[model samples]
Target: MKKFVLFSVVFLSLILVSILFAIFSFSLLFSQDSGVKEFEENFNIRLPRGTVSEKIYDDYSGFHNDGVKLYKFVFTPKGMKSFVSYIEKQKDWEKLPLSQSYQALIYGGEVKDFSGNVTGFGGFAKEVGLPKISSGYWKAIGDKSVITARFIDYENLDIKTLINLNSYDFYLAIYDTKKGILYMFHINT
Candidate 1:
């Protein structure tokens, strides 16, 4: 009887420990300052477990009825893979090739220095810290990285179509495998 009781206590202790760990993990991901909740609420997509927000930018002009939101998140390698897999399985997202035209569209016009030399695009995307690919930005994702967007017929569309988008309403997720970071950009007008 004592042996059985000991086993029961051990098992119960293990279960309790597991429950606490799960709670703690959940809290860490969704904490007020984590930005996970806001991102999930706005995008209707939940980031992978163990992901943490690194930076966020929110701009809105309710009067003008247009705004942009950008979020940067760092993920564990495993979490990054998991997110890529999840996005791949989602019907709404379309993987986009990492092309110069799309990069231009995302970054807007070329930025120029005081001497009129082209620097790079200067916008909230720059402010949010999207990797600067124009100057060989190493942090910028490459061919191996997954780039996915939504709200357009990407299959039949070309870069020109993306460039011509008037009221840009789209969601883009770019994964940096080397740095294990995910950059999300959203535009609504």
Candidate 2:
């Protein structure tokens, strides 16, 4: 009876240790830092230091929009500038033209006509200046069955610029006319 009790205790301890080891191994395999590493490798740009969030989704499926894996990295002012500089160094990126109408909106000017012309009103342009870069007229096509969907009227700007690297199109739109935040997206075509 004494021998059986001792063996039972030993067996239970081994099982517990095995469970703990497996948990640790699984966690190490899927650590968040690994996501950051993967992002840097895929984009060829170092992620700015700040809060980073990641989501993996099926392509064009469900409520989650765009990319098989989406990573949003929000940065401080300094980090934003650093990232902007990094993008500026890329060979294929170019400054996108800002239309007069879009400029008016950015500067808080009223749109007098539907021609999309900029009519500056306040000094918002002088104060805030233009966003560093904006890009894309992103058509978020959710359903293929809908043939007659009206396109949302928004001035598409290339915030930083656009680049085609390794058969993938990269767009970095730092400012949304509505949201007024820095963001980026890429598509592999």
What's the lDDT for residue 186 in model 1?
62
> Highest lDDT among the candidates is held by which one?
1
Q: Write the per-residue lDDT of candidate 2 for residues 1-189, one digit (tens) a residue.
A: 999999999999999999999999999976766555655554456767763544332254524343333334455667667766765665543344345433442334554444454343441233323333455222111122222211222223221211111122222233232332333333322
Residue 83 shift from truth in candidate 1, angstroms: 3.0
Question: Positional deviation of 61 in candidate 2, in angstroms?
Answer: 6.8
Candidate 1 ranges beyond 4 A from true positions: 1-46, 84-97, 109-124, 133-157
Which ten contiguous residues of candidate 1 have the minimum total lDDT?
A: 136-145
Encode model 1's per-residue lDDT on 6-31: one tens digit a residue: 99999999999999999999988666
Query: What lDDT is obtained when candidate 2 is compared to the true structure?
Result: 0.42
Candidate 1 — number of clashing residue pairs? 2
TM-score against native, each model = 0.51, 0.39
